[model samples]
Target: MLDPILLWSGLVNGLLQGAIYALVALGLTLIYGVLHIINFAHGSLLMLAMYGVFLLFSQFGIDPYAALPIMVVGMFVLGYGLQRGLISRASHGRDENILLVTLGISIVIENLALFFFQGDTRTIDVPYAFDSLEVFGVFIAIPRLIAFAAALLIAGLLWLMIQRSDVGRAIRAVAKEKQGARLVGINVEHIYAVSYGVGIACLGAAACLLMPTYLVYPTVGHAFVLIAFTVVVLGGMGSFPGALLGGLLIGLCESFGGLFLGESFGQIGIFLVFIVVLLFRPSGLLGSRV
Candidate 1:
């Protein structure tokens, strides 16, 4: 039997990891909610943002946290441009077309990074790399704590934006009824781009928060793609709060599973929970009826 302290530590770690997972999934869910398409390129975009943070830190000696605003704006521009200049033109009113386009984009991004960065894994060392916070006899890494706080703050802000902002209202209007939104002079195409940009912006924040503890490579995004999808599905696609809760739950499972089942087999728990959820509650924990 594991010590109670060990179990507590595992749970803490899992919650920390889950917060970052929620941050990552938030973008995917938001895009799906607004655009109604699965962005196969999301992981690739995350990979790109990680690279952006890496380059800034490596070349300019800037801290990852300090680069947050820069990355968010840059990614937003890239996402906006992609949506306005390519995705919209290519989508042609078909979700399948958007899927293909995003898939192609992912492939292109991976190859470009491979060609440019040569697939070498990169990591950053911050001043607080080894720092930790002691809480009730448990030591939690500072970076993990920061990630948890930042993720929650961003999620809250996003929820508020969606719930209260005028632009957000336009986004919802377009998401629910594009023709009606257009009739009301909501620049439907621009709203699509903005929504996509906001979705990608979340990844920018995620990359910065993750860089202090995570490594990056051309294929790093691949590792996250599966987990992100799981969170989205488990949380109920297009539901922000659902994604948040699902992420934390998945994180706990991974943590406890690793403790009891060993590292190699730990992931079995995630799959088990995923299957069980699908079998019983397909709509998800907080998701509405499908």
Candidate 2:
């Protein structure tokens, strides 16, 4: 039998990590929802943001948190341009064409990072990196907690934008009925660009929050992109709240599976749950049926 304390600790840690994963998953789902494209390069965009934070910290003495606003603006511009210059051209193409284009973009970005930053791993160390808080016999890493708070704040803001703002309504209108939106004078192309920009901005936020806890490398995005895809699929594609719930579920599975079944089985446990969900609830836990 597992020790109760150990189990509780794993659960707490899992929740914290899940918050970070939610950020990434939300970004991917947003892009998919609006653009109907899988964005194979989404993780590579995150890799770029991670490098941006690292450079700001190491070369300019800017803290990762302080650099977040700049990162968001810069990533938004890049994402907007990519949509306008490249992705928009393929928007009308078949799904395979869009997939190929995005895959190409991902490869280019990865190689470029490799050429400039090399394959060496990099990390940012802040004063709070090693700090922790204990509550009810459970220890929580302070950095993780901060990241969790930031994730929830961003998620809440996104929810508000989607629910209350005119731009958000426009985005939803385009996603739901592109032809009707265009007929009603909505610029579908521009909305697509804005949606992509927002998606990448989410990645930027995730990058800043994650730099304190993880190492950055050229290939790091590949693993994260896979995990993000798993989260999106598990939560149901295009479901915002579903992404959060799926992330927490995956995080808990990884944590508890590692504790009981061993570290190697952690990923397997997540996949097992994913498969079960697919078999029984194809639309995801909170997702609406298509």
- Per-model CA lDDT versus the true structure: 0.92, 0.89
Give lDDT tens digits, candidate 1, residues 1-290: 77888988989989998998898898899899899999999999999999999999999998999999999999999999999999989889699999999999999999999999997999998989879989878999898899999999999999999989999899888878998999999998899899999999999999999999999999999877789899999999899999999889899888888988999898889889989998889888777796
Identify the leading candidate in terms of lDDT: 1
lDDT of 2 by residue, 218-268 (tens): 988887888889999999999999998998888898888888788887788
Give the winner by TM-score.
Answer: 1
Candidate 1 displacement at residue 16 in angstroms = 0.4
Per model, how many backbone clashes are there?
0, 0
TM-scores, each model vs. reference: 0.98, 0.97
lDDT accuracy of residue 141 in candidate 2: 81
lDDT for 258 in candidate 1 is 91
TM-score of 2: 0.97
Task: For each candidate in turn, give its C-alpha RMSD to the true structure in angstroms.
Answer: 1.0, 1.1
